[model samples]
Target: MELSNSTLSSVAGLQVVVCVVFTLIFLVGMLGNSLVIWIILCNIKQQFSTVMLILNLAVADFTVLITLPFWIYSFADGWVFGAPFCNVLLYVVHCSMYASVFFITAMSIERFVAVLYPFAIQKWWRRGTIGKLTIGIWVSAFLFAVPVIDQKATHVEHPQCSLLLSSYRQQKGLIVLETLVGFVIPFLVLSICYALVAKRILKMTLQSKSKSMKVIRSVVIAFAVCWLLYHIINLLTVSSILTKTSSPEVSKMLLNISERVENLAGALAVTNSCINPILYAFAARRFQNGFNTSGIAKLFQQLNISIAEKFSNESNIRRDNFQTSV
Candidate 1:
């Protein structure tokens, strides 16, 4: 009886912790993303491909975060919301998640190209290519998220909003699919693009030793850190489904541990939505400082300037230096 009481108490404690963490995330994400949108729209009078991507990302992050209140209540109490509503909520979340990932990847690739082939990016901008790309991104995000509508929260004694796939095979498939599309593919793209950007910055002597590299590393590392645990735990679940254990007790034990950690892992993943605003601020601090010093007008002028033009001039300088050295 004492052990039973203690077990219940521990479970209650964990539930409280989950609720608290999620609540904070919801508050912070909404505010931060709102500020990002406002700055892009009102403060920064000039729009560019990079700014457009940032604006879309902020919108995506904010849209998904709006669902957090419902989720938090689901966690704190239970999933009182009907099954139909659950599906709708999941669809929106999935759509926003896909959009957020794509935009971040798009931004990274854009930056990479700006450093290597600045003129091409400029020509595309003149031709309004970025606007078309943005439309395509949203369409793709919505289409990719359709499958998630079938997700129904697990119905139990408490009716908690736990996303349990319909079948064991389905579970594995969804986990693999989401991990690949959502994190792995994007992670690889971000890593490669940023690494190249860092290298170019070094070659051009753009920023002093290691500064650009550090920011590049942080961007990749932050992306990895946010989603890596969730994927690992999910992959483990897939492995467990495939591998049979001799001891039922051991299997049950492993299952229990994964169950507890998986929720926390999921929370960590949601955190990525909120954390991007912070990373963006840090990454653009130099530009932001200029805007700050010169006020709103300065920001407007600076943001209006084509990033590709600056890189083009820098590349020309490097070309000149190389020729002179020869």
Candidate 2:
């Protein structure tokens, strides 16, 4: 069914709702990610690959959350920010988006390695090497975001920011590239890593695993679901654009429906940034133990899950050394 002008007004109203919702998400994300970063930096004596990965992920999420105010404002009002500023902000958003994906995927790979080749990790994956790799990931993410610089701000009825090129061929190419690189490949890698980890976990008793493992599983599942919906909507929109060749009217209808759905898909995609810290609060034993004095700690403590096995294992090692010296 074709939507009338009233339906277009409803879409605008939904965009306003998106602004309010995104603002709330930003506040919560900033608080949660900051706490995660603080706990990791202040309390941890020795940094491991896991620590570095989590720290980077928190930083990336924080960076993304910070840019959200501009987006919220632009959604509610028009894009008052000039083209250069809009482009820069969009670039930051894209970089952080990909960085989150990379870091999450890295976490899964790190877990898979830890579970599958514990001894090899110490030898093959040095902390310094992992740190360097994290830097490389950030640099690559920034490079991936270079396409945003081409986006220009236009003011006709109202100021709007959009792609400079409106060619159907170029738009299709860019969308296909984004879907393949941004969504498909990283997601596939994440799934495979987690599948291997899950296979290994199944061999062990439930009690033997860490609570953080379950948290990781949940994060992966959430990422998959949210981004899967986001990308499906994107593909549908792209298909609709392609259909202009056969039937312009049908294409216009599909595009209108896609536009109406865009807010929900975008919200789902942005939600990944807000979920990481909550996962840590509930599932990460070290986070609970390290921040014991805080209110958040109380919340974490109430979560009835086993402590991470690494903490207990470290204590065991210390006790063994003490006994050997005696």
In terms of lDDT, the best-performing candidate is: 1
Among residues 3 or more apart in sequence or in different chains, the pairs in candidate 2 whose N, CA or C atoms overlap within 3 Å are none
Count backbone clashes in candidate 2: 0
Residue 84 accuracy (lDDT) in model 2: 73
TM-score against native, each model: 0.84, 0.81
Which stretches of candidate 2 lie above 4 Å from their native place? 1-12, 151-160, 205-208, 284-326
> Per-residue lDDT for 95-196 in model 2, tens only?
898888888888787777767666555654544668787988999898887766664322222434555445777668767767877789988888888778
Instruction: State how far residue 72 of model 2 sits from its true place (Å).
Output: 1.2
lDDT to native, each model? 0.74, 0.72
